[model samples]
Target: MIDSQSNNNHFISESGYLSSILRAPVYEVVQITPLQKMEKISLRFNNIILAKREDMQPVHSFKLRGAYSMISQLSIEEKKRGIVTASAGNHGQGVAFSAKKLGIKSLIVMPVVTTKIKIDAVHRMGGETYLFGSNFDESNKKAIEIAKKNNYIFIPPFDHPSIIAGQGTIAMELLQQDAHIDRIFVPVGGGGLVAGIIVFIKQLMPHIQVIGVEAEDSACLKAALLKGKPVSLSCVGLFAEGVAVKKIGLETFRLCKKYLDDIITVNNDSICSAIKDLFEDVRAISEPSGALALAGMKKYICKKKIKGEKLAHIVSGANVNFHSLRYISERCELGEKQEILLAVMIPEKKGSFLDFCKKIGKKIITELSYRYFHKENACILIGISLANRLNEKKKIIDNLIINKYKVIDLSKDEMAKLHIRYMIGGYPSKNILERLFSFEFPESPLALLKFLKNVSTYWNISLFHYRNYGTDYGRVLTAFHTTKNSPKFEECLNNLGYRFHEETNNPAFCFFLKK
Candidate 1:
């Protein structure tokens, strides 16, 4: 058995900050999850790719380690008084599981929009649940209020010493499991997991590179590192809810700035692709935040043209809500570059469609939508599957353009992917006065009706698109018939107080929605 205290003394410096998190007392509740070699991925990348299976932990996440470590070390009096915490999902389960194991009362405050699977998991583990607010920041405040009111010890999700130490234990296991590790990729939220891993790796192996990964829409750590302090994001994307923290923890930022070799951000598509990759490799599905490290590693290796090096990515968690899979599965193909989006214009004549098909010779057509309005010309939105390199897409596009087909690449266009693709139909109508706007509102029943009630009833609703990703906010792509283009429209929108973007002249909107 490894002596936790001796390990602390052996590796820690005189600094209290580093010494306090040398080892977490999490062995009783946390397991040393397997460090599995990703054979197919290694072959493809021409590198030794390994995955630390933290998703296999009792709570199916690394969070339990930290939660247990923090709670287990509390004094008897503190334990009797109980504990309180707030989490988007995984951390609450961790705390609930830890509290149950330790015979301590626990209450978890979660955002109202948290997925049912996670909330149910916490309740099943014996934690009292409080659904409050719209996001983590709001829920965290409520948790603090309750803690103060009840005089319970408040355990922060990722900011405390013992919590960080517990997560760092994974690094100890990684070193013992594989000494040949050349680089380690870890996902970052408030930065607890990455900070913990870094404290150990930098002190012990110093030569190994530690890379932190974050969602492009929720990159608090990267933002903090660049700005030299934690700054709140104006808005955060909820696709990767687990790591949707708008700000980094104070202590976590300090450690990450000092030790992390590099920090990279990945888009939602890349995250979805990484989730698919993990599923392919181990038949294990990872949540968006969980697959973040793999996505970053892929981008890093490709950009640097690095090969044949041994790399490891932390599979942070696997507590994905099942319903979210529909969105992920739909997007993963595009993420992997297997699906390509193209806008093609053809002659609006008999057999012109056949000519277009001939030009796209032998390619698998995933989607093809064409509507002829003008007597002389027609436009079609097409999705094709590419069996060859992504460069092959460029060649295909060039070939179509050479044949007098106007081609626009919609593969990288966010608007096209999220809204336009599904709503591809109907040619431009004359004097209809189409105006496009994107609106954000709380995800709740009658939110759409409430929005419509606020807008002027004089305008006819022309185009509308809405999708719920099981998040706190709902986004809607809406078009209305209105000729009022002066300050009146702006004044009306300002009065409504809804966060909206005018897409009236947006390129994608013009291409697909407008005449």
Candidate 2:
């Protein structure tokens, strides 16, 4: 079995960082499985596409390989104390799995925002858990403090040497499995996986290109390169929460500077689109972070005209929440196709709708949200989808011109949507007033206060809309009286309060299904 001895004596000056990673238990090279059709369409580089299936590793992701190796390096004394970590997602599960096998006490601290699915997964693997913090950063901070106070061994997600060593073993597996590799695209978060893989490959193969794939919303590498130092991002997009890191780890970043070829950032829409493609082609439910490599590669191929190149994207994980499928479906179209948002003013007459439909024709309608303002003026917001690599959206715009139709494509103009869409809906009047609530809103009633804060200054509400299910929208519905003098809905409810009525035979409330 490989250990610290091989690492110590192998390469002190030139390869010490890489040597620590080479001795991981996952020594076998991940098989370089060639996808037949994909390789034939060669890019700017050489062909013979190789998919190094690190996803096939224990725990179903490459995390185990690193976590196991990192934990293994602990001294006998340290091992006796066991380990603690903070990960509501993959890292928590990985550490737990590793600790369980090693017969160590594993404690995982997760953020309260963590999904039930992940929490249950950690528990199933025999890891004790503590839920704390509102976000990952908060949870991580608490975990660090706990480790220091309790004297529990702190197993970091990607910053530790043992972890990096275990992760690097994937590179060993890749080289040993197939020596002929052109490029490897790995999903990146804190740079652990990419750093480990790159260090090993460059030390051994030196010729292979190791690219890092990161979410466009939180591109630590791109920001770091631009700034000439690591900087924390103000905010990051949440769709690919797994890899949405504000900053890269110190140790991983140091190695990445030397080994990684370059880092590519892809947006949530693109990552979601890649997830759909992977699901359809491989029947694999890849998480957003996991599918990032494929999305980046596709974007790169289109932009750089990169052909004749052997490409492999990491299908990193499958621990996807079932509820997120709707999000995946929504963004998939936007990712694959350049979106065109238009507000068309058509006559409210009978044949006007049909006339506009005729102008739209074959282009797919990705989104359709409508508003009826006046009897003569009804507006329909349309999101038209166009292929990024192939279709020209201007053709559709040109058709609208020839047919004497008004058009405003907001796809390329985000500022237009941010500042204009709300104003575009209707003239600010009593008719436009809405009592909006959403389940996604934080539990604090600040939005309600904001609404009340603005009241009596402008116009009074004539109609208020509220439903119990408005939790999805977050604007709770109180009883709204349409007549003037503006009755206070809340006061009446407070006075009379709630009424309890039971009707076993009530048709609306019946649970029985009719045949």
Candidate 3:
């Protein structure tokens, strides 16, 4: 066992975390998860890629380590009072499982939009459940209030000393599992997991690089690093609900800033791709937030052009909602850059489609959408598969342009991917002055009703598109028919409390939907 008193390091001495982590009773409830080698990803990246299987824990997440550690250390009086916590999913399950093991009661407060799978898991683990708020932050406030009212001890998901030490136990097992690791990639939510890992790794194995990964839309850690403080984000993406934290915890930010080697942020597409990668390589279905570290590690290796180095990332959890797989399957190819979407202008005549196909050669067509829209010309949206993404895509586009066909790349267009492709048909018959906008709001029946009530009362809706991906947020593409060029419509949207982006001038909308 590592002794804190024998260590001369100032950080270890001041924090006393090395001893606390070593003495933590997390192993009683949590197992030493395996460090598995990712054979397929390793071969592709030309690096030794390993994954820490935190998803194998009883709660299907690393959260149990911290939850059990903190709860086990509670005084006798505190234990009798019970414990309360707000979680998106995994942490609540951990607390519930731990409390059951200790013969104590636990109350788990979750967001209204949380997946039924997680809520059910908590209940199965013996936790009394209360659904409240729309996201973690709001739920956390309610949990605190409930704890105060009921005289229960509040258990925070992150941001406490005992919790940090419990999570640090992973780093202890990691070094023991592999001695030649060049870098360790950890996912960041409120920064607890990454902070704990960094504190332990930097204090002991100072040479091994410790990197933090975060979802691009929920990158509170990166935002904090820039501003030199734990500033709150206005909104965070809910696709990766586990790590969709609006602000980094105060204690976590301090450790991350002081010892972390670097921070990397990944988009939702990359996260989807990473989930596919893990499933293909390890037969593990990881949640979006769970695969965040692998996505960041892949981006880092590609950016640095590093080869033959040993890299490892945490597979944090596997409690994904079953309905989310459809969205992930649709986006994984795009994230890998192995697929591209294009809008091509073809003459409105027979043999034009065949000629276009021949011009692009024998490449695989993943999707094609066409309709007779005009007498002179027609627009067709196409999806093509590419082995060499960058070069092949360029060649296909250049060949079409050389053949006198107007080609617009819709591969990177958000509107095209999320709405336009599915709703492709024809534009309005009359030349209507329409304003197109994309909006996102919390996913709930009440929230949707509230959104419609507010927007429909103010403007005449011309086009609307929405699909539920079993995520916490609802995405909608809508058009309002209006002759006024005033700021009143935008002002109304702002007051509606939904995130909106103007897509009226977007190329996809202009080519396919505008009259």
Best by lDDT: 3
User: lDDT score of model 1?
Assistant: 0.84
On a 0 to 1 TM-score scale, where does candidate 2 land against the true structure? 0.77
> Which of the two candidates, 2 or 3, achieves a greater TM-score against the reference?
3
lDDT of 1 by residue, 1-515 (tens): 12211212223331443455554578888888999988888999999999999999999999998889878888888889999999989999999999999999999999876777788999999999999987899999999899889988888888766777788889989999998899999999988899889988888799999999999989998888889989998777888888989999876887888888998899999999999999999888898889999999999999889898999999999988777787788788888898899888899999999999999999999999877667998878999998875588888999998998998899988878878888776545675777898877776666667778767575677888997655556778988888756446667776765668888887767776687
Whole-model lDDT per candidate: 0.84, 0.64, 0.90
After superposition, candidate 2 runs with Cα above 4 Å error: 1-14, 27-50, 338-341, 362-371, 383-389, 412-515
Please give the lDDT score at residue 392 for candidate 3: 93
Cα displacement (angstroms), candidate 3, residue 369, comes to 0.5
Which rank order by TM-score, best down to worst?
A: 3, 1, 2
Report how far off residue 358 is in candidate 1 (Å): 0.3
Per-candidate TM vs. native?
0.93, 0.77, 0.96
Residue range 242-293, candidate 3, lDDT tens digits:
8999999887888889999998999988999999999999999999999999
The predictions' CA RMSDs to the true structure, in order, are: 3.6, 10.3, 3.3
Compare candidates 2 and 3 on lDDT and give the better one.
Answer: 3
Residue-level lDDT for 440 in candidate 2: 27
Q: Model 3, stretches more than 4 Å misplaced?
A: 1-15, 485-487
Q: Considering only N, C-alpha and C atoms within 3 Å, which residue pairs clash in candidate 1? A: none
